[model samples]
Structure formats: structure tokens, C-alpha cells
Target: MAFRCQRDSYAREFTTSVVACCPAELQTDAGGKKEVLRGFHVVLEDTLLFPEGGGQPDDRGTINDIPVLRVTRRGAQADHFTQTPLSPGSQVQVQVDWERRFDHMQQHSGQHLITAVADHLFGLKTTSWELGRLRSIIELDSPSVTAEQVAAIEQSVNEKIRNRLPVTVRELSLDDPEVEQVRGRGLPDDHAGPIRVITIEGVDSNMCCGTHVSNLSDLQVIKILGTEKGKKNKTNLMFLAGNRVLKWMERSHGTEKALTTLLKCGAEEHVEAVKKLQNSIKLLQKEEPSLLQFHSLTSTWISCLFPLSRKEGDSEFMNIIANEIGSEETLLLLTVGDEKGAGLFLLSGPAEAVETLGPRVAEILEGKGAGKKGRFQGKATKMSRRAEVQALLQDYVSTQSAEE
Candidate 1:
């Protein structure tokens, strides 16, 4: 049996009797937090809320004022997941998310038009397609799609939209001869009831079970954004239809304006200005090695930590500075840069002192390390707190001296 949603794509509200309702759990990750939601799996005699299928997401709506979290097709039935349960045989009003539903209709119908036009003009078949939240992709069974082909296909689809082509849907039996004329991959294994076919007046016809707009004018507009290389020598065509195109344009224009302000140049010069800044950065990077230096902190400790403020050097550079200083009786603290920002640190000296103080110094620097014998080495962060490490070593040395 055809659901109310599939029968009338424009219908947003309907009253139906609950066939059954059972305890259910829905796992959700809203706002990046994952949790299992306790809910009811509601089965209505008929539903206007389309389930997740045909590459389109499920419709979000309300059943008797309770938010419908998800909908899935179970054979011939549409299962609506809701937080509250409805009594079996009880009447309830269902409402669909019209904005979301209409957006999907535009994209799905637009795909039909594009696939038809492409096949008619270039014999390029659409292997698959995705109706993404931001944009849609149609994967064509071809190595690459040229700019000229994209422009042509885009022009043709939009022209048909302007022409106000009438889109009609009808259901037929599996053995119906007319079914062979429509374009389709095949019916799903779990598909029940008659096969639904969508046809564009004087354009093309295809078998699809998803909801769609009744007229091409409802699509508003179609924009082929660009193409991407797909796996296995296929070309994925990315596009936007209806409101998505407007949203994309708004975001792109805002980005251009922001770039113009940041670069202090006109829109056209923004590219050159950014390139020049990149070149300047490269030159600075080349001069970074000369910043390294070695020195000692007080007579109580020898410090090889340097290029103290240099951000360009890494741990290997710090190791070289320590090598230059050689072994010594006094405590040694070597760092390529400050841990508060980034870099590496190494501490070496008396065996017992190194063992006791290594972990403490690592904690102070906000980094982890392992040490044994007379040497403690590890990557460190927040090196700006190196003063605390020095103070700790000085106090330990003073304590030992007083004991002796």
C-alpha cells in the first residue's frame, strides 16, 4: 500500500489511527554527544511522514504533539519513532516538516531531470547520487566530465525548469509492460505494493519511490557547482538546487568580502596578495636556524636551552645544543623553545636527582616523559614555566648541600 506521503508529496498534515506502539530505544548523537534515547516505535495505519529510503533522509515531524525523531520503512509499514506512545486504534494528527520535505523534493526531482537530460544528450548514465545537507552529488559512469559538458547539462536542466515541465507520479504492477519504459536501476528486495514511476512531461520518466514536487517551477533553479573525481574512474557532479543555491551564493559572497577586508585589496587582487604573504612566510622560515644559541643559568646550573623564543626549531635541534654542551657535574636543562607554546626539553645530572625531579619537571612543563640513570628526556609543552623547573632544581641542590 502507498503511504499518504508518497501519494501526495505536498500534503503536510493528516489524521491516522495507530496500528501498534511498542517500547523502543533510539541511539542519537545530537550536538556530538551520543546517548540512547528511550522512545516508542509507533506504527500508524497510514503516515504522511516519509521514512528514510530512496537516498532521502527521513522526515522530521510531530505525532499528536510529540516530536517524531525518526521514521523507517518496515516492509509495507512506516514506523515512526516518538518519545510518547499512542494507543492502538486511537486517532492522532501527524504533521510533516514541510521545509525539509520540500527541499528534498526539489533535489530529488532535480536529479531526475539532470539524469534524463544527460542521458539524452551525452548518453552518460548516473551510477549513483547523494542528497547531502549542503549540496547534492550525482556520480556519472565516466572518467571525467568537462566544464563544457557541465555547462551544457546545467543549461538544459534549468531551461526545462523555466519551461515549467509537469511532473507526474503513477503506480503500476511489477509485470506491467509500461514499467519497462521508465529508467531505473531496479526495485528494492523489500519493496512491496506497486512500483511508483515519476515522469517529466516531454522530458523523461523514471521509477522512484521518493516524494517529489509536482512541477518543475517548484525547483526554482538548479546550479551545477562543480565536479569531483570519484573512485573507479567515475566523475561525481556536485550541484545545488532551489534554496541551497541561494545559500551557497550568500556564503561565497560573504567569504569574498571578508577576504577583501583582510587582504586590504579588491576581490580580484585577493589571490595575488595572499600569494605574496605566503612567499614572505617562506623567506622567514629559511632564516629560522640562525636563531639558535647556548647559555648557562647561574653557576649552580648549566643551561643549554635556547632559541628560547624561536618557534621554528624542533626536538632534534635541542638535542644538538645539549651535545655541544657535553657532560657536566652541574645540573643541565636544555630546551629548544618554551613548553607553554611548544618544543622539546632534556634534563641531565646526578642519578638520584634526575630520577626524583624528572617527573616533577615534566608535570610543571605540562608534558610527559620517561627517564632512568642520570638523563631524563622527553617532549615538553608550555615551556614558559621553565622557571618553576629551575627553582625546583636549585632548592634540591640547596637541600643536599646543607645535609652534606
Candidate 2:
């Protein structure tokens, strides 16, 4: 079936009626693919269901109680594929889901708003648009938009929406003077027949094929999410409109509330609280050496009080003490804790010592680590005994040093 562009000539308020219905029999050819022969027919004096074209999704709704699964253009005719076949000459009422229809209208109209704004404000023409999940994006003939320019354009679009300008759709022949008056040079000159011109009153006028709102106010809001570089000399802009903007705000505020509670701060104080927490962490890191040195003495004196077989909780303290000692000689420090397991640090007299003994110690501890120059650090997953690690380190140091 050949594709036909219908929105250009069709009015926004129209409905389709079923013309014929019959059991569509399937026939297979050489390829064995089933092809339905004249399944059903729909004839509408006019239709509001915009046929799939211009990168827009088709309108969805039930017709004569049968769901319209898909809509396609067949030459000058618009074909509506229904779930169930309808009787021939049945006067079925078509109902378009206005909410869904209006959303597409809002987004399509918003594209015009932004595109027109871009041309007027920056002399850049919008080359294309792709309506997306989070936001609709428009591609401009430029590579980038200055932050200030984007802000100004966004402000202008919202202002237009706020003004509630009447959006008038005019159908004119190719030679219409009104077409020449507001025609965008970028529009193809070869486009034949009547061109649908959407005029935003005194704000904008351009040739468009997609469905649009009757008024600017229908958009409610126009938000510029962001911009990115597209193809050569093209910039893509992401934006949202109406319900999408409201939904985004709701989700964003909910996230902020969750973050505020987790940070233990009020909504307004969240940023400051996060900054303070980061600063406190930095201060503790700087004071770790002195603090660990003091704690090491307590651990040594209370060695009997503590277990000869350390648990996971004690591994962190052991690592701190090892780091505090900061030895120049080859040092192997190991600490075992119940919950956290064991931590091991191997420091070498020279870079060569680590290369020789590091992998061997890792294998003994059932761990993994790699280092160069002078030090190797890693954690053993679950070491049951401190003596096991101590004996392995001693054996490696004695034998390996002798060989060197």
C-alpha cells in the first residue's frame, strides 16, 4: 500500500464510519505467507485519527466497540485496523481518546513554538524532531546553543504559552500569498497541493504536517531539559510539555525528599549538610595517623583483654596500626575480624621484594592483589587464624630474602 499524507488537508475534528465488514479469508502464495483478502472497510466523511506520519504515533481508541489496533495510510485513504471485523455499511461511531490525542497535539505544537523561536531568535532553523520518553528533542541547523540563548528561548516559549495565543490552522494552495508571507525557506519547495500552515497568531507561522493544539494554552508549560551536539552543524534540544512537566516535578520532589531524609537534613539544608558531611570525612582521614597511634597502645596493653584470635571488627584497627608504623623494612601486617574478615598489607624494603613475595602471600591467604614499585595491599576473604597468616609471611620473608 502506498503512503498518503492526509493531515495536511483533513480538519482536526472529524470521525470515521465503517463502510463494509466481511470475514477476511487468508490465502497463501509461493512464499506461504497468509494474506487477508479484503478483510474490512472503513469509510468516514472525515477522521480525527491522525494517520501515522511525520514521526508521530497514531491516535488510539475504540471504534464501534472494536479496538483500533493500528492505523495506516493507503494512498488517499486512511485505513483503521480493528481487532474484530465490522459489518458492511455499519454506521459505527468513532471515539478518539482526547487525552492521548491532546498530548500529541501539545508536543507537536510545542515543537513549532521552539522551532519558530529558534529561527527568530538565532536565525537557526529546526531541521527535525524526535519525540521521546522523558522529553521531545528538536534538531536545529546549528551545533550548539549558548546557555544564555537557550534560557532566553525557553523563557519566550513559556511566555507564549502563558499568553494563551490562539493557534489557527489554515489550508492554502501552493501559490497562496499567506504561504509566501510566513513560509520557512527550509520547507521543501516541491511540496505540492494545499500546505497546512499553523499560525501562532502574531508569534509564528510555518508549514507543518503533524497534529497540533487549537490554542497555545493547551501546552500549559514548555520546559527545555537540555541541548546536545547532533550531526554536523546541528544541535539537539530536549524539552517537555504540560502533563510531562508536572509529572517530572512530582518525581523530582519525591527524590529530593528521600535524599533529605537520608542525609538527616531539611529540604533546604540538604546541600549544606552534604558539604559538611564531606568535610568531616576529610578531617577524619587527615587525623587517622594520630588517632590510630593512640589506639594501638591501648590494643597492645589490652592484648590479653582482646582475643589472640581477632575477629572481623578488629581488622580495621589492625590496618590502621600497620599504616601508622610506616616501616622502611619489609613489613607484612595481617588482622582478622569476625564480621569483616582479614586485611593484609605487604610492604617491601625495595620494589623487587613485592614482585617476589606478593603473589605467593596472596595464594597462601586465598586472596588477590597486585602492586608495583614497593607495596602490595589486599584483603583475605575469611581467614580463620592470625597464626596462619603470620607463619606464611615469616616463611616467605626468610626464604625469599635468603635467595635474593
Question: Which candidate ranks first by lDDT, i.e. highest?
Answer: 1
Give me the overall lDDT of model 2: 0.65
lDDT of 1 by residue, 1-404 (tens): 79999999999898999999999999999899999999999999999999988778889999988999999999999889998889999999999999999999999999999999888889899999999999999999999989999999999999999999899999999899999888899988999999999999999989998999999999999999999899999999998899888888999999999999877789999887777666545644554454322233433343222223345455444444445543545466766564447666777767777788899989988888888767787867778888788788778777776776
The global C-alpha lDDT for each of the candidates, from Candidate 1 onward, is 0.83, 0.65
Worst 10 residues of 1 by lDDT: 300-309
**What's the TM-score of each model vs. the native?**
0.70, 0.60
User: Each model's number of backbone clashes?
Assistant: 6, 7
Task: Write the residue-wise lDDT of candidate 2 on 52-130 in tens digits.
Answer: 6565677766676566655655555566766477665556667676677777778888988998888899897887788
Which residue pairs does candidate 1 place in steric collision?
338-383, 339-381, 339-382, 339-383, 340-382, 340-383
